[model samples]
Target: MTDTFLIGMLVLAAGLFAVGLFGVLARRAVLFQLLSLEVMLSGPSLAFVAAGARHGDPAGQGMFVLVLILAAAEVALGLALYLRMARTADVTDSDSIRDLRH
Candidate 1:
């Protein structure tokens, strides 16, 4: 509830988001990118929980749940595409997947 604690939590949230962003930008593999995207989503989820706790409000938690659902859907879709690419073209790098047409 203290300002210091809240600031620390926000900093941590920012760090998580930054790390995930870096991973997404730096990695070329589809799987790593997907994992990084999850991490990115987690950053906001943590921030929402922390803010909700700090303010004694349930809205933050509700937002976190929504974010969780979004992340899950993204993972499912991403994995499906990755699998399809893997099976059909043996491609894992994003740059190599320029065209979907065969």
Candidate 2:
């Protein structure tokens, strides 16, 4: 691919990351925040893959795999906590979950 392709990928990745960040910060819903966090994570994965391809290095692919594992674990744990909070505390509101700071 050409430099233009690389730049385009980078721009797309940045856009995705920014949108995800905004969603996380602006939304009060826990599920939406989790999804946004996933989107944010994907942005860097795209950048790393693009860079690895551009440089003909395998490290980028390896890093992406690690990120995928991390994302999976995050989703699993986040959902578990969300469910626990919803069931035990009857809480869906983030502000009400301040007891978690303990």
Candidate 3:
């Protein structure tokens, strides 16, 4: 593949990042925000893989794998916390989870 293809992949990944950002900012559901955050994380991971392919270096691929693992851990922790919150509260809206004291 040529540099154009790699650049295209990067552009596509950037688009995904932007969409994910919008979802995180615009969505009301905490779960939806978390899902969007994961997508945002994965987009860069994909970009890293594409860059690694272009440069013929395994480091980028290794970083991508590490990021995947980190994303998985993040989802696991986030889901556990979400489940706890859901059990205690009837709402899952991100805006409604404010428990901070005035």
Give the candidate number with the greatest TM-score: 1
Candidate 2, 28-68: lDDT as tens digits = 88999999999999999999999999989999999999999
- Model 3 lDDT per residue over 1-102, tens place: 799999999999899899889999999998999999998898899899999999999999999999999999999999888898888876588778775333
For 1-102, candidate 1 gives per-residue lDDT tens digits of 898999899999999999999999999999999999999999999999999999999999999999999999999999999999999999899978886555
Model 1 TM-score, 2 decimals: 0.94
TM-score of every prediction relative to native: 0.94, 0.90, 0.91
Most lDDT-accurate candidate: 1
Report the error of model 1 at residue 4, Å: 1.4
Q: What is the lDDT of residue 63 in candidate 3?
A: 96
Task: Report the candidate with higher TM-score, 2 versus 3.
Answer: 3
Return whichever of 1 and 2 wins on lDDT.
1
Global local distance difference test of model 3: 0.90
